[model samples]
Every structure is written in structure tokens, then in C-alpha cells.
Target: MTRHGKNCTAGAVYTYHEKKKDTAASGYGTQNIRLSRDAVKDFDCCCLSLQPCHDPVVTPDGYLYEREAILEYILHQKKEIARQMQAYEKQRGARREEQKELQRAAAQDHVRGFLEKEAAIVSRPLNPFTPKAASAGNGPGAVTRDSLSNATPCAVLRPSGAVVTLECVEKLIRKDMVDPVTGEKLTDRDIIVLQRGGTGFAGSGVKLQAEKSRPVMQA
Candidate 1:
């Protein structure tokens, strides 16, 4: 027997014959025979092709055989599997490479989008109309007492590019349904009060008046 516990030899034979002619009945005789080393190895395979099993596969009953040979012998007895196996392996390799490339491209796109957003935020310009503190001198753009005295109370109209007094806006809204300048529909909701810096336009008096009015306006 081999190390895997398979019988490595042929069975014994028992021969018996009656007395052929004159001798009494002869006792039974036994003959024992053994297989060679190559034959013993071949006996382990289901295919019995007399070759060493390169890609060995074990059966449920603990028998070993070459994988392809046994598959062809049992399943596709007459067909070949070489071309089909090669094609399957090639397709699997191509699919793996395609998936890798797709992942790489997606990563690159994400990184590029993040960089573009950061660049846009970093390069954005500051607002030019933002207010700054004025020096004590009478330079250009400085707020002076003369300018404050000249400043007047006004209300800006929406979509009409018109500036008028708050009292005129209140009277127009009360009398007409549309703006006299642009002919657009007028409502108390469209009025925006304007205030001059360092002037009395945004003082407690205007706040008191606004608090007393309907749809209260802010300066």
C-alpha cells in the first residue's frame, strides 16, 4: 500500500483442480502478485493516464488525479478546455486593469476639484465699497460738518432709480397703486430709507417716526 492508504498491488489468486487423471485431488494453491512502482502511482488516478499528476485534485472518496485530465475524462470527455481557459484568464486580467484605471481617474478628479475651490477662495477680491475710518483732516472722501449739513433725508425707490422724501413716498403709496416715475406697482414694502454718515438722518427722531409707522422702515 502507498502512504495515502491505497492498495498498491493486484489481488491474490487461488487455483484448484480435481485430480486430472490419476493423482488424488490436489490441495488448493495460491499465487500472489504485486504491481510495479509506476503501476502503483497510476492506480491512484481516476483517469489512469500513467503520468504523474501535476495539478492534483482529491475526490470525495480520497482519490487523487490531475485536475484537467479528470475534468475532461468525466465532464467533457471529447472536448478541449485549453482555449477556453486562456480566454477566461485574459478577460479577468483586462477587467482588473479597467477597474484600477477608473479608480485612479476618480481620485484625480476629486483632488483637482478640491484644488480649484481652494484657489477660488484664496484669490477672491475684497469689497471696495467697505467703509473705513476717516482722518481728522478735510481730505477727499472725508466726512465734514458742511457735508453733514447738506445731507437730506430721503427714501430710495426700488426698480425706479428714484430718490424722494419719506413723506412723498408715504403719500404716493396712500394715493396711487404705481410709482409716478417708473409706472411700476408701488407698495410700502418697496421703500428703503437712506441715512448720511455723521448726520441726524439716523437719529432717535427718525427711529421714533419709523416705530410709529406701518411696515416700519429701517435706516
Candidate 2:
């Protein structure tokens, strides 16, 4: 009889334990004997077969997101992009309007300064009865109260042919409270103060106006 849990080294021949009346079926050259359930139960050894893990975690489809959820997410992203685009467009429009207003104010200031200068020069008290003096006062201020013929241009004025710059106009505008839309309010200050011979326009403050605009789209 071969004992269970016995460590054996065989030289040539080996034999397994034969139960009663079973040697006939275990005969011949070599026999592979399978253990009976009763014999396997009688053995005091652990026989644990490792079973393959088959816990199912099946996905809905071939993709991670379902079709409807993916569509909804895409729509939401598009809406967000559209909202951003709309906001950018509004900002661009506002900036353009500001630039146009600035340019317009600058142009108006330049024209007004030129006209004033011309008026002063034409209004100068001429030598009576001289054809040359009469011909000299033939520019834009031929018939204005503050004629250009009597006065020299302001020191800040540029040469006759050069384009008038916006820097001086901007300085003057900041020093005074003026409406940028219309040139009518250029000298709206109640009092003018002189400090070291430089004129300063004095007033309460810049006026505030409220206007309605389209609301920016939210994300």
C-alpha cells in the first residue's frame, strides 16, 4: 500500500495502492487510475481548483458615452462657444465705437483750431486805404468778429501743410469738460484759472449719462 502524503524516489518500477476487487481494470502495461469520489473524500488534503474569474461588467455599447448623452454634451459645448463668440463680438463693437468717437473728436478739434486761427488773422486792424492789406485778409475769416488777419496763430499750431495732431487736442480736452459728440461744449467751464501763465479750466466734474445696451450671453 502507498501511503498518502509520502515522499518517494522510484528507481525503476512504481505501483499505486489497489483497492479491493479493482486490480483487473488496473491491469496491462500502464494504467491511469482515477480516484473515486469516496476515496478522494477520505483523503485529508486540500484540493482547490482555481476557477477563472467571469464577473461580467458589460458596457452599453462600443463607446464610453451613450448616443443621447454624447449629443447633449456636444450641444452644450456648442452653446458655450456661441456665447463666447457673441461676447467677443460685442466687445469688438464697443471698441470700434470708442475709436470712432476719438477720431471724430480729434478731427473736429483740428478743424476748429484752424478756423479760429484764420478768423483771428483776418480780423486784424488793417492800415486804412491799402490794396495790399485788403488783399491779405481774403482767407476763411473774411467776415468774422474774431478775424484771423489781425492775429498770429497760436504757438501750438502746426505748419500750414502738415496734418493737425491729436496730442494737443487731447490735452486740452482733458483740461476742460467737453462733449465729445458735439464741439459746442468745448468751453463749458464757468471759471478759468491762471497758474504761472498757463490757463486751466475749472468745473465740477465730467457729466455722466446712462444708456442701454444688449446683455452679454451667458454660458
Candidate 3:
């Protein structure tokens, strides 16, 4: 046999060996299995009703409940608060009305008291204008200055067609020469001065002196 030939006779015989099934199983040990999204079930509500929740609301304590149920609870509490406020306002309004009624009654009482006092004053019998006593210094018919001061000075023209006294003439002059009682006219030259021992007759003399001193104006 040639050593360089294609099939060398000096080479050792070779045999093909197949892999064992137990060694292939031992190569891959126990694997860590992970579950998919389809395998896990959805979480449910933690409420006492145990009903299914569509829109979930998470509390601060990390507890989940139905949104509509919790909102209804909050609304009920708010309604209670509103009712309390309305009752309080009604009580306050009633108190204000009572105070106003009391004030009105007090005002009416004050007006009644004022009217009673005024009626008492009007019912008095004393005449304030009547003189108490006549003094000897003043004549029998003569009125004192104190008595005449508050009296309304009046003038009466006698039917004799003569102006009587200076005091009467002055009173007539103040009334535009028309007699206060008889409505008759009197002249300054016709006046007679009456001696009453008082300066009451001085007005007519002063008036005459003033007229004499005034320059006559020609028109």
C-alpha cells in the first residue's frame, strides 16, 4: 500500500457518536418563570358594598373606592351644614325684628308722655295777664310801666273828634294815624299831653322835635 494515496491505509478508524437525551436535559436547569399580563386578574374595590367599581377613587390612606359613592357622601355632609346655617340666619332675623318692635313701642311711649305733659300745661286755670295789686303811687285808673310793658298798646278815638293824650297820639301814629279801636284818623296838633308823673309822654314830644328839625324838601 502507498503512503501518499487518497485512502491511506496507515490512518486509525473513526466512529460518529450521537448526543444523549439525559445530558441535554441536565444542561438546562430549573428556570425562573414569569407570568404575563393576561395571566393576572384585575383588582376590585375595597368598599363595604363590595360592588364592582368603574371609576376608582384612591384615598390619602391608599384605599380605593367608587367615585360616585364618595361624592354622594360629601354632598350629604354639605347639605347638613347648609341647613344649620339657614336655621341660624332665621333665628338672627327674628331677634332683629323683636328689637325693632321694642324700639317702636318705646318711641310711642315717649310721644304719649310728651302729649300728656302738654295737655296738663293747657289745663291750668291761672291767668298770667291779670295784674295782682295796684300801688298808691300810680293813680286809681293809671297802669304802672311794669304792667303796661307786656300789654298790647292800643288807641281808641273818642266821638268828640279830639285826639285825647300824647300816649294815645303816639300809639295812633304807630298805627299810621288810624285809631286801633274805632278806625278813625287823628292829627298830631290835636293831641293833648297827659301828666302821668312818668316819662311815657316823651315819645310824642321827641317825634315833634324831630319833625321840626328835619328840613322841608320841595318837590
Candidate 4:
């Protein structure tokens, strides 16, 4: 028995029935009959040793098997890493949403406080409801920087609503302790206008006629 490269064993002489007429006079007696042109020549030869074969059971250390195992391992690792990354990305997205909500809430609080003070100032009825009364005497209250010492995060009144910036507020109230506009003293009314527009009073200047009967103005 002649052993081929690796672990293959060459069996008795192989004979094809179609080629039998040509080799009939030859002394090499046939053992097994070849079925077809495509049939393997050696039955004892490990089929896994062929070029495109991938029978791990026949040749565990074949190139196909080793490479296949390595590729499979890499693919599995890629899937696992992708799953973990997906979970991490989800968690990170949730955290970002939470942070945005907190920022919005803080901004709203600053605006609310500013509006309340302005409302108190503008709500106060003058001695008379006439246009002259509105324009007379000391005139409307003006916002200054000194009054908003406790204010946090500067606020801007917009037609839609109030806008608050954390950095600006800290600078205005804590560091500079001044109003962005007027560049003068900060008053409680200024803080409110900063929070809500001056026109926001009486829900867009809707006066309460009954309040005129009161002896003293209520802010």
C-alpha cells in the first residue's frame, strides 16, 4: 500500500471499466471498478485533503477547518460586541434626555420667578386708570440691576415665552450683579421683564375695571 502525502493510503490498482479494453493485456490486475470520470480514484484517501473539501472529521487540522473555526470565532465576537454597544448606546441616549429635561426645568424656574415679580409691579393700579395717569408722576417702573441680586440664570422675554441661559444668569446675578440691558441698577421689575415681556401684564393689557374701586393699589 503506497501512502500519499499526509494520511492518505493508496489502495489496489484502480481500473475504469471504459479503459479496460486498453489495459486488458497489462499485467496490473484491477481490484475495484471506477464508476465514472468524476469518481474519486482512491477510496482510502482522506476526502478532506482535497482542495475544496471541508470535512473536519476526516482532517481536523486541515486549512479549511482551522480558517473556518477562526472566522466563526471572530464573527461571534463581533455579534457580542455589537449587542453590548447597542445596550451602551441606549443607556447613553437616555442619560442625555434626562440632562436636557433638567436643563429645561431650571430654565423654566428662572423665567417663572422673573415673571412673578414683574407681574406684581405692573399689576399695581395707578391713582387713576386714564392714559394721563398711566403716563404721569414717576412713570412706569423700570428694571435695574441691583434688585435682581438673588436671580439665577439671566432671562430674556420673547414673544412666545421666556428664555433663560444658565451661564449668563450666573454672570449677571452672581459675578457682575448687573442687568444685560440699561447697564444700570437691576430692580425687581427688571428681573420680571427679563423673565416675561412687559406686554405680558394683564394677559396682553386686558385691564380689570373692577380693581379701580379698591382704595389702595395691589401688586
Candidate 5:
């Protein structure tokens, strides 16, 4: 007996419909749609509403959008951006404080090390007549060096939220550190040095991409 039926022989060709096609069930898993010539493609739809626009507007980057829908989208976007910026500034200030602490610790360590070395030198016995003359100063080969960093990377001004580089801060030296935009009075302590990574382009990419990356900032 063959596998098809007990009556069928091994050489017999078995060709019969095992399952009938159902209009509802068979077609459920497949779709082949054809758009009419008059149909509007997705590109012609409003970017914000995803519908054919009555009052269309084109953004600077050439995306089509409905006027009212786009305006509302922009308003919400501006609010979201402002909130994100505030959070960023708060986090940035915290990090700035941490960096300042690190630098202060380094400076204290350097001073402590110098003092330890000075104490060791003074405790050692030395000939009293060996080094009083100006010509007896240590030669250039002594090669004394300091490890503390004196250069400021960048500076952030508070109250007005302005950030300036070290070079600009240097120009303000021997004078008042005033806010360039608001012309508000500033002090030396107001110039907080900044430290951050280069993530501006990456952030922009996340903001501009499709649904996959859109929620990063909003989240």
C-alpha cells in the first residue's frame, strides 16, 4: 500500500486536492494591492498627520506637512527641547562640580608631596656655608617640574548660562568677567570650567531619524 491510501500502488501517481482553498482563510495571510494613478503616495501626505493635506506647508528640509498639524507639532517639540536642555544643564553642573573636586584634590596632593620633600631636605644635615650666594643657585640640570594643570579647558557663566573657552576667559583676565550677551556683571568664580564629550552630531542624528530613534530625547 502507498502512503496516499491503502488501495494505491507504489507506481501509481497520486494527484488529488488534500485541502480546499478558502476565500477567507487562504487569503488572510497574503496581500497584493495596486494603487490607482490618482492615489496619493505617503510622500504627498502630511508628515505630522500622515493624511493628504488641505493646507500644506513645506519645512526647510523639504518634508511636506499640514499647516495646523505641523504648527502644533513644533509647539510641543519646542517645549520638549526646553525641558531636555534644563535637565542637561543640571547634570552638566553636577559633573562640573565633580571635576573641580578632582582638580582640588590633585592640587592638595601636589602641595603635600612638596612639603614632604621639603621636610626631608631640611631634616638632613647640610654645611651652613654651602649655599648663601646668588651664584650658588641650582644649575639648569636640576629639572624641577610641577604636575598640576594650570590651563582651563572651558568656562561656563551662571545666571545668563553662557559658555566661553579658556582663550576668551584669558582675554577677560585683569578685568571684569562680564556676560557678553546680557552684559551682566560676573566674577572669577562664576567662570566654571566645562568638560563634555563630542555627542552633538550623534544627538542630532537621533533626533532626525525615523521612529526607531525618535524617542531618545523625548524619553
Candidate 6:
């Protein structure tokens, strides 16, 4: 019988009771991984595979993963993380470019407002007949300020990439936040603290504005 208790490096930690009646359904192997009502949520699941672990291994961050699945992830997923990050940065760069154009319009609006107020001082732009109002896209400050908005979800942790699920954040917070794929350790500095939205949702705590996402390991 599989033993149920806290995790250790030596043996399988079974969180749910089972009679070894598993079929080869999940494609991992023919191991009994059926979940029982007594199983604890999140506490008994694999971090990487998000499935019940037959051969559980605990990381330094105290997260559980299936031995074979995590080992495979550690070996091959490093490149996957890199690919994901490259794609994410590419998209973010494009968004920043768009934001710059929007910022130019905003700066023009500001200048228009200023001109309205200083009608007596200068009725027109300092061209041949008007003034040369600042270009919004030309200023570094404008680019910095306008690049970020509520529409942008913080992408500081690229390991999660577009898949910013709750499980993703959980793996990020505890311990040193190891990415099994890259064997990289992420600090809080790597995270872009999110601003609260109208929905009062952000990454202030573990609970993020991100949608829900998922499971286990043994001896």
C-alpha cells in the first residue's frame, strides 16, 4: 500500500487512498493515480505535470512533481522556456511601439491644453505663425510613462509567459522560485508588481487577476 504523509526524498507520499487499481488511461503508466475525496487539494499534486504523481519528488521550493515528468522537464523544457520568453518579448516590444504612438497623441493634447491657457502669451505654435509643440514620441519620459497601462498584464516573470495561471504564481512565490525548465531562480525583483484594476485584482498577494489553473507526486 502507498503511504500517505508529509513529503520526503526517499519514498512515495500518498495523499489519497487507492487500491492500485489504475488503468493505463493517463498515458504516464499503469499506476494507480485515481484521486479520492480525502485527498488534499494542491498539496497532493505534481507541480509540472499537474497530475497525481506516482513517483514524487520535492524541489527546494517545497513543490511536488512526478519524478519522470519533472526530470523530462528539467532536461528538455529549458529550451521551451527560452522560446516562450523570446515570443513574449517580441509581442511586448510591439505593444510598446503602439504605446509610443498613443503617447505622442497624448503629448499633443497636453500642448493644446497649455496653449489654450497661455492664449494671451502665445496665440499660436512657434512655427512661422505658430510654436513648435513637443512631440510625444520624442521624449524618453513619455515612452516610459505611456508604455504601461491597465491593458498590459505584467510580464516580469517570463517563465510563466502567457500562461499566467494561479499554479504558475504558486511556483514563483515559495523558496527561491525555481524554474525546472531552465533551472533558473527568480527573485521578487524579477516580478513586475501589478497595479490593481477596476476589478480590484492584481498580484498583490498570491491571488492574481489571472484565471484559475492546476496536481501530485509519491515516494
TM-score of each prediction: 0.24, 0.27, 0.29, 0.26, 0.36, 0.23
lDDT value, residue 157 of candidate 5: 62
Q: Rank the candidates by lDDT, best first.
A: 5, 1, 6, 3, 4, 2
Candidate 5's displacement at residue 181, Å, is 82
Estimate the TM-score for candidate 5.
0.36
Best by lDDT: 5
Candidates in order: C-alpha RMSD to true structure: 23.7, 29.4, 35.8, 26.7, 29.9, 37.1
Candidate 1, residue 164: how far the Cα is off, in Å: 0.5
List residue ranges in candidate 3 displaced over 4 A. 1-69, 122-219
Instruction: Report clash pairs, candidate 3.
Output: none
- Poorest stretch of ten by lDDT in candidate 1: 139-148
Question: TM-score for model 3?
Answer: 0.29
- For this target, which candidate reaches the highest TM-score against the unseen true structure? 5
Q: How many pairs collide in each candidate, listed in order?
A: 0, 14, 0, 10, 0, 16
Q: What lDDT tens digits, residue by residue, belong to model 6 across residues 127-202? A: 1111123355321111122233344433334343221323345544445575433456766644444443533455
Provide the lDDT at 86 for model 1: 81
In candidate 4 the C-alpha lDDT for residue 158 amounts to 26
Please, what is the whole-model Cα lDDT of each candidate in the order they appear? 0.57, 0.42, 0.53, 0.48, 0.59, 0.54
CA RMSD (A), model 6 = 37.1
Q: Over 4 Å off in model 2, which ranges?
A: 1-64, 122-219
* TM-score attained by model 6: 0.23
Rank by TM-score (best first): 5, 3, 2, 4, 1, 6
Q: Tell me which of candidates 2 and 5 scores higher on lDDT.
A: 5
lDDT of 1 at 9: 34
